[model samples]
Target: MSGPAIEVDDLHKRYGDLQAVAGVSFTVERGEFFGILGPNGAGKTTTLEMVEGLREPDSGSVRLLGESPWPRNPRLLPRMGVQLQASAFFEKLSAREQLQTFGALYGVPARRVDEMLELVGLSDKASTREDRLSGGQRQRLSIACSLVHDPELVFFDEPTAALDPQARRNLWDVLREVQARGTTVVYTTHYLDEAEILCDRVAIMDAGTVLALDTPAALVRGLQADTRVALPAGLLSASDARALPGVGRVQDGDGELVMSTQEPARLVQALAERDRLDGVSVRTATLEDVFLHLTGREYRA
Candidate 1:
């Protein structure tokens, strides 16, 4: 309790010739919402699995709640909950039944099942069979099952993958509620925006290594990536935009024109004078920009 909720030191994993996690290390503070972010095959899941005691690391150490996880420690499992990337459920089982079953395994009270269902917004569909629930509803049930025992630490791997925008937003609220109740959450997702808004701190992983770990704002600020200017496409030629003072990079983002500039005020004034400020908007670098800068690739692919 005095130390970090989770501590990983020089963790490594290998699958034959493939090295999944390579000497990764980080700490999650007590009750903090920590996120692991990366593109596909970045070893985020492998690292999380090692820390969760679900898989053995090739070398190094992991301490969850201040105890070793690799040796299959009994004390660690009950105090920690996990929602894997994919969960299996009996097609015929009701959502409530599924939670009740998991609760019984954890020796948790049946009342806890109802509480979890309500917490994850599944009470209305509590009686719906697993096969009958929508993707979002099923995902909520998966989350409810993980929290049925009220573990001190929870690990979620891509909890919002494949969800629609609205469902994803709703799940974000559920995760916020979970954190509000004082549960330390270790989450992994490909969604950089989700990581930006949800995580207290994030570790960006790639090629079996942790590229950077820090608060979202700190990471973006570290880049010193200039302010972003957005406006309708074709407002200015790429060459002319680059010719502007303090402008660093000009990108055609979809149909909108985006440019990075250090002197936002000057850029705004210039655009206004040129009648190019009709739909212009100025903002700071986002987590997505930072991720792209660090990895030299898009977060999605």
Candidate 2:
């Protein structure tokens, strides 16, 4: 409460000969929205589990809410909530009943059940059975279950892993509202763009190690990447775009001529002066660029 909400130092975990998490360290400030990003098998979930006290680490230490999380500390359980990647529930239980069941575990007040339903946008589907809910709706229910007892710190493991685009965006609003209410949110996700917009700071991990850790803006800025200027394909050929001022690299993109430049404003000014501004679009470096830069574009398991 007085210091950081969560602090991890040199965390390590191994199964057989494979190292799942190697030397991971980071801190989550009170009321901060933190993100852990990595490819599949990058140990994001394992690191989160160790921090949540659900799994024992092979080395290093974790201080969660000013107390050790190992050995399954019961005192900390009530203050923190964890949503696993695979949500679990009774198929026949309605959304309301599912939440009530979780609230019962913490001896929460009866009114809290309705509060969670509304909080996760499940009030209309309160009577819908768990099996009947859509993938996004069920994911929302899992989140509501995690927060039924009013946890101060919540951990989400890829809450929007497989949902449709619109649903993923909708869940982002709910996550933002949770942090707005002063709850510290620490979650792992493969969605780089989502983390770029939602997280206060992020840790990009690969091969069980943290490659970069910083705010989304900071990470992108540090990349020192180029800005992309695009124009209608027929407006200019790749050779002509290459000759334009401030153009460093030019390639023919799908239906457009893409030109990369460090001086975007200068390039735009040049284009404007040339009366070639039609259908012009500018693309700046993004967190996805930083992520792909850190973890190469190669396929990952």
Candidate 3:
């Protein structure tokens, strides 16, 4: 396989006495949509900032497309785009003007501005001032500004933090378009559902370290030891269900019998034999489950 488009090796960052990112390591292959997830103060922002060259790591290293991410290499700055957690634009500047100004900074042609506006579905708002646009529109504009120079890799920091459902979906589509164009993306978000839907692979970080890193499916399946099987209320009693093959625990709840097992197929078949399975629901597990198991905290907590 080719070397990763973005690579971090034992990255460490600090703020005075506090260790913000501690020996975290991961890689994003070229053209892949990678996600980083964590709660507040989990060092996610610090890690991303280091990779984006907005901040320096106290130790270890980060490379973007095979070069150091820090020291702001002039030749490399144009090949990368970034959407900060809090985007600030000149309030009086029109969307078109903002894009043109940013384009000039990267020596990008003015035509690229129109292309970016269209790419983010903001072409109709080109004449709108930054302060006059709605939150969602401004967010779209921020994304468009990042791509004005057509960077090969883009870093998105909580890109959908405050958007409505439709706006968020629009952003997702835009990101999909970016990926289809073969741009590698490093996305950090608090939304696990967004990560599940958008990322090819994800790294779950907390307390300055990665707790798990894998494709969403694989990560969820890794929690199979606690598989949950939900069947209709009258289907089976807790005691009878526990005696089934591979079922280690069973609980009655909310008009269903919840069974936990490492081998769901065996338990499922056992339950099926007695005509005790109805409205059966089997889930492979999820990032939320992994997060809960690993940190002893809920995914949203």
The candidate that achieves the highest lDDT relative to the unseen native structure: 2
lDDT of 3 by residue, 1-301 (tens): 3678898999999888999999999999999999998777788888988888889888999888888978977767888899987999976899999999999987888789999999988889899889999888888899888888888899999889888998899889998999999889999887788889999999988899999999998988787657788888887778888788888778898788888888888987887787766689996677877766776674444
lDDT of 2 by residue, 1-301 (tens): 4999999999999999999999999989999999998888888888988999989999999999999999999999999998977998976999999988899999999899999999899999999999999999999999999999999999998899789999999899999999999999998888888999999999999989999999999999999999999999888778877787889999896798889999899889988988889999899999999989988999985
lDDT of 1 by residue, 175-279 (tens): 999999999999988899999999999999889999999999999989887898988887788888888777888997688888888889888888888888887
Off by over 4 Å in 1: 233-259, 269-276, 298-301
Pull out the clashing pairs in model 3: none
The better candidate by lDDT, 1 or 2, is: 2
Pitting candidate 1 against candidate 3, the one with the higher TM-score is: 1
Task: Show how many residue pairs clash in every candidate, following the order shown.
Answer: 0, 0, 0
lDDT of 2 at 282: 92
Model 1: lDDT equals: 0.89
- The TM-score of predicted model 3 comes to 0.87
Which residue pairs collide, candidate 1? none
Each prediction's RMSD over C-alphas, in Å, is 2.9, 1.4, 2.8
The candidate maximizing TM-score is 2
The lDDT for every candidate, in the order shown, is 0.89, 0.92, 0.87
Return the candidate ranking by TM-score, descending.
2, 1, 3
